[model samples]
Target: MAQDSGAPEPDDKLHDECGVFGVWAPGRDVARMTYFALRALQHRGQESAGIAVGDGKTVLVRKDLGLVTQVFSDADLAAMPGHVACGHCRYGTAGAKGWEAAQPHLSTINNVIIALAHNGTLVNFDDLRRELIDMAIPFRSNTDSEVAAKLIGYFTQRGHRLRTGIAHTMRMIEGGYAMVLVRENALYAFRDPHGIRPLVLGRLGDGGWVVASETCALDISGATFVREIEPGEIIRISDDGLRSERGCRPLTPANCIFEHVYFSRPDSVKDGSSFYLMRHRMGARLAQEAPVEADLVISVPDSGTPAAEGFAQESGIPFGTGLIKNRYVARTFIQPTPELRQMGVRLKLNALPDVVRGKRLVMVDDSVVRGTTSLQIVRMLKEAGATEVHVRSASPMVTWPCFYGIDTANQDQLIAANMDLEQIRSRLEADSVAFLSTEGLFACVPPNGYCTACFTGAYPVQIPRSFYEEKFLPGYEPNNLAPASKTSQMTLVQAEELLGQEG
Candidate 1:
């Protein structure tokens, strides 16, 4: 018998890289606070969860291949008590999906110990890993995060302070990342130069501080939102005080727009507005751009609810629940036969005939990746007696692959990248299908620089030729917004030479 890999059935959805949480609080249960924060951020990643605590003397880490709830219990939390801690929930985009690949990754520098929780992919980590291997630095996993931890350890072992080592590592590594690191008595947080990922700073009571990938995590931990961690900024919190420093020069801001369209929880705030409102505005703009005459406006459950309500409000169509999702059906480790595998979507969602029967439904979804789920959902709705099923995507079409932190398919696998609007509608067998225009999407979010690479094919960070050479189909060229060669702000040789000069 073939053993199941315990991975979720392959679906047509873009996955965020991971979620990271860090807190510096004395005379409090920091581990439990981190656990609750990770639970709130469970939507960001589900494959693994881990927490590392610094109890003033040494750093302790516990991690495994499971959800946060599954990975820790009351006793587990009680065993690990600390003043500073960091946690991670992973939906891996970079390396193997195994116990060893789970983070917060731990590394040592002589007498000092540190653990790192990261949320993004490092584009140039392959070369950096090779360099570290050549220098005889051992690695426990084939993950960019592990490489990052080892790089910091290597630099710190060379007589530099931990913060200095981190700054040097920030200069040498390239990609979109939001990282939270913890040593025996201090907590550190930083972001990449481009700010392609999200990280927020929050105040916990009078003497504590917290940082997380989303504001929702702060809400769960009773932390008040302070502000976003600036691009290339490093924040350190310890007994002495909280301080901020520049890890590297900030590049042009390129926040991932998908966080507003999807990824983030509805209640999470960004730029003084909730993601629910942003998505609602996206649906309203979408309705203005692509209006369809339908008797009912229904969403694909939780993710698309706000958008569907906005569409209904804009189009004067009555909104109702047409599909019910089985909340418990997250992932199944069972191996099914071919015929049973075809019925996979049925295991997660079911159509409500009483509500949708004989009604013309405009089904709104977050986005269509490969169109497989949309097609199955359309057929299911029709089978449940929906008169006509018109599909509406709340966001613009995804035509290019995301290299920063999102786990999107290759260019050839994306439906919009390979087919036109009519072709997509035909393939899904829907009455009609329409997506939000890119301009309309921009109008819905706060005015700021964004990485529209997945929709516009214009990459903010330079992608290595060796990395993306075979990722695209023939004749589909990517627009490199940044210079094509060096992804890192400072090369490893330059950094090492600078260190030599300092010596």
Candidate 2:
């Protein structure tokens, strides 16, 4: 959505939470340090901020709806001081955007209590919620994070200790998740078996240990990057170093593709691949797969620039700006209505008449979900006198709601999921439109791993038979998305062949 840089335009709906940070030490002002960590992660989320700390035996939490700076008065931070702290700045995507559902959920079971903060989602949330309700489990907040906490509590009654309880929760969990849990004197860091989510370990020179969703946060906290928590692995950390264990069962890793494409900081290195380099390669791959003749190439904005560069390098097309974005516009995608959305998009981006006038332009965007912004940008380019506009997407067309934490788009809300390319091009009113093949995207990742279910409808884990809004029949066979009658499915062998072809 476009909005005047000087105007404080308000948006609702679209939000991205910044990140999570946790630190454990025998004794210190951990809450004070948590405030600083949240400050550094401020870029990831701006809607609400919180800090929950445990001083070995007691857990104290304070969270509210607002920017980190707005929520943390010096008094507020110091008033809630402790030695072990877990902090979150949330942009509400799945749960109610109210204070009641904020992160650092506290729950107790079998007389043991745990305070949990998580990055990512549980694929089996609805089913679990239903089962818990059936068993008369009471719930206060409507959030998957809370659900996770409750699941751990539920399993604790089955005679599992903290580690065993966490392992049991892991067995119940599906989809992308990296969670940090504080129980008693220890901090536990665990990743989903599929490794769809990212978890990083860092060490403070002063014998402190921190676990966070990304390495960038660790750097900001002056913690040295230890390593990525492996997929299907759990590491329990305390002052006595770390004792790593594995998930009871293992699943193949399928890291979310959008992390490299849009979500993560360019400075972060997920698994083993550089986020910046992967995105740059995505652009290059897009150009190689969908090259077209145009007078010049322009990216959607900052997110599109790296790939745009790659596209230019590979397509031999001179890249230049046809549109200029106001750098100061703050969070306008929050607009509640279509009229406001269009207005905001126009306000954020204005066409550069001098550069684009009478030129054939190729535009690159990271991904298109609602198509509202894409249409507005297209109209702006036309109004700027671009004779022809060709649109290319760096990532494959998003065809499904991310079951993981991303929550990018819903099944029916996705234009690509429901429409063919020709229909989308016509709807967006572009001279031409192209999407990177799923195979093209496979070649984009550095082989760290990928979850391409958004484009391929091939979930890394089995999804629930039903959502609250939609009922899916478990008996119904999946749509078998293989290329032709010559195939049963895009098996690993076929995917490898497609990857080779795209490369």
Candidate 3:
């Protein structure tokens, strides 16, 4: 077993915002089910975990900064006795990372307690926050999800029902989101107009209702997969039954393509297609586009496994596990210092000398962000006696920042944006390197149904110039006094400080 190098692998890939799960089951242990379901969707986030359980008359929430396993204990789950529960696994996209930023943000609306778990980013959070703060609404965190919850609460407190408040809130917010909210007596789940995030509804064998970010959560909770919650639709569940209503008319179906390429767990299915199968198809497409002659095909396990299998099968090459991952090293407490990061790759994955001894290798990975990790992998394989390493990527090169809830907003940090394919291959010490074509990616989803903004620079929504500069280049002030774009407005932090003080 590879011992921990005293640090986790530094961030090398685009990160999804979060994962949400909610359950409404009167007789079942909804809290435990939520915990298990969140455990299944942990891949979506690792920064924080939270669970909010609501009985008929009261709601209790517990959240903290850590992995789900580290945040909640058996005693904690047992203490949360309720018929309704909402859980979240978070990786902050719109807010500064902190313990207080954990989700299932709780608020009171017309004295009705609302606890919400969100899995997307909102572009107009700053605008919405300005509106709410003007109404004297107090805020506890800087996250966009909290802004959204407050917007809904504001309307609910003004004589509107929960459903109507949510509808109005949806109209005011823009961007990608899949949300699950629990009230004192009922549970509500909804998707944004664009459906850039994934949310699915499932049925438990014991007459319970489950909603989650992926079907894998449903499988873990012993629930049968139900249909996906349509974009612009809101579903409410209570003792009476489940009811759905259109929250807003969808502009277009802009599902995040990264979900299929890298975010989702392989065992999970989305849009009637298995995530693993989609990666397999991407690999096959890569094989057809960039053919290579190698003795063996190896994956950068475990995200690289499906694509490598597809590459090997399509190319008629033998597939083998050339790298062994230290599963326990996934979420380590080790600090990611410069020295530790250089050693982190070796600690997470070690080359199998026996598998690659004197073999020409075709290595497949989901995608590359900085190329440092890829360089380390190629170096390790070469040190283990691999004659050659041909690197292949399953997704097209990511050259633009994602403003719809992914953590790839810095173009300078993106290796592909700064280097050509040959330059990248030279940096990684690979014999050759190739990425799947954008056309190949479009083939993986329904026509005009996916967002490839990061790869093609075709943003589905307008972005503010300040937003881009804030993520890509800090400390540089814009000379123009006007906003960056028509859609690019102030952020909540800026809006709060600028729109007069609120104590």
Candidate 4:
């Protein structure tokens, strides 16, 4: 479905740009299974959906720019008969959109079909893309996932086995990626060296195998959770069963901390910790770190409910849903004007005057991104006659952008980046505001087990300054992207010359 170009775009939330699901079930409807699992993981992305299925002899792929339900109909799933399948939901991390940017990205090598779905961003995408372009490898989309797929295809055609090819590509690529790829006979999954994104393996009751971005997908597919694919591990699944390899040397694991704070479903588990429990712990810690006097604890809804409950439990304040979310309203719309964008919040959530009237409220939310929504919601609560609203965030302030999979704002757009806690409180029109301390956040999770770079700017992966600028300025033309005077539209000779300079 096409978005209305004239509608105001909702711009409040942080979005993870992709989710991946894969299954190798010989006797099952793998395509439908993938559809269901993708639905379970849909919160990670919304721009597009795709599935690629493969039997022993043939691979079939269908993908489009829509929600998972809109893209794959029952008829479409029924037509794709296969023993192995991979699915993807995407949120357009790169500037590109439409059908062209949808995954599972398909490529052919030596008559073998390969379809891949990826869940993270590549920091060195320019370098890798330049290499592929110089080699005259045509690209279907402007996505780092395609670069990875083409590289894997290139190596497979050079006499390397599929697993070997993927392992080699992993070595050459830099940045966070959790990927699931399907070939005619098998399914392959791997994660980046830092594991900035989450991928987990699961077991089907009928002796099949599954791998997905989160455990919730397994639960929906009736698969039992097994374990997370290690930071640098690769696993291959075929009729002969599963095989594993250490694709790259492990760096300190940097599993995204936001997965617990926001991105992941509470039902999902990562790194042996339940995301729900971690979030609850985070809220409890927040209450300890920033105690507040309040008559009621209210949540922002859905994402904030769990933490709000924890805050209530720790503070001995009653927890109530003072705001109700309109489940049918889409998260985003094409708001063409700033005025309409500001009004869009009421369409998504409404304050309950009866619940909040004359009450001093402690409102717990997962995190504040740009602070626009926070201000709007606070103002809404005030209009409903709340005496005071104290904003409490379960996570430390997000002051930096995420370079992994998450679609975070540039530092300039982040409210915490430009203002202190008191300044943010004033801007949000709240009586008081406090965020979970960084140390409190670490205490809530496994020690040194996750990435807090968005809060601390301590990126586990070294990043070039240019990558940050490239995200907002699409078609970024830097000397590193092209050579001295060459543009991306240059011919093969120009790309080759650029590569030669790098060599």
lDDT for every model? 0.89, 0.73, 0.84, 0.83
Cα lDDT over the full model 4: 0.83
Best by TM-score: 1
Q: List the residue pairs that clash in candidate 4.
A: 7-334, 7-335, 8-334, 8-335, 9-334, 9-335
User: Residues 1-503, candidate 4, lDDT per residue (tens digit)?
Assistant: 77556745435568898899999999899999999999999889988999999988988999988788888888999999989999999987536787878999998887888999999888767777887888788887788888889878865655357876776677667777999999999999999888888899999998999999999999999999998898889999997889999876777777888887889999898668888889898888899999988999999988988889899999999998899999876434244475555575787899999999999999999988889888999999999999999999998888777777777736667788778878998999999999999888888887756777787777776665667663332432222211221122344345334434534
Weakest lDDT window of 10 consecutive positions for candidate 1: 484-493
lDDT for residue 445 in candidate 2, whole number 0-100: 75
Report residue 293 deviation for candidate 2 (angstroms): 2.3
Task: Determine the C-alpha RMSD for candidate 1 after optimal superposition of all C-alphas.
Answer: 2.1
RMSD of each: 2.1, 8.7, 5.5, 5.5
* Candidate 3: tens digits of C-alpha lDDT, residues 1-503: 78656545445678898999999999889889999999999989988999999988899999998899999999999999999999999876546678768988988886688899999887768767777788688987778989989978765554358887787677667778899999877999999877888999999877889999999999999989989999989999998899999987766777888988999899998767788998998888889999999999999999989989989999999999999998987454557765756675887899999999999999999998778789999999999999999999998898877888888767778888788989999988999999999998777655558777887777666565645655543433223212223222444334334323321
Cα deviation of 200, candidate 3, in Å: 0.6
C-alpha root-mean-square deviation, candidate 4: 5.5
> TM-score of the candidate numbered 4?
0.91
Q: What is the TM-score of each candidate against the true structure?
A: 0.96, 0.85, 0.91, 0.91
- Model 3 RMSD in Å is 5.5
Per-residue alpha-carbon lDDT of model 2 for 1-503, expressed as tens digits? 76545533332122344478888865667777788878777766777778887766777788887777777888887787566788887766645678777778888876666788877776557666766777789988777888888877765555346666576667665656878887666778888876777778899888888988778888877889988888878788776778898854555667877777777777887657777787788889888888888889999987778888889888899989877888766443244465554475776788899999998898998777667778878898998899998988887787666666765535666677667899999999998898877788778777666777767667776655454235222222333222121211233235334334534
Q: Runs in model 3 with CA error above 4 Å?
A: 1-9, 336-339, 446-448, 470-503
Where model 2 places Cα greater than 4 Å from the true spot, the runs are: 1-18, 25-29, 39-44, 109-113, 134-136, 157-160, 332-342, 468-503
Clashes of each: 0, 14, 1, 6
Among the numbered candidates, top lDDT falls to 1
**Per-residue lDDT of model 1, residues 401-441, tens digit only:** 98888887368879998899999999999999999999999
| Residue 457 alpha-carbon offset, candidate 3, angstroms | 1.1
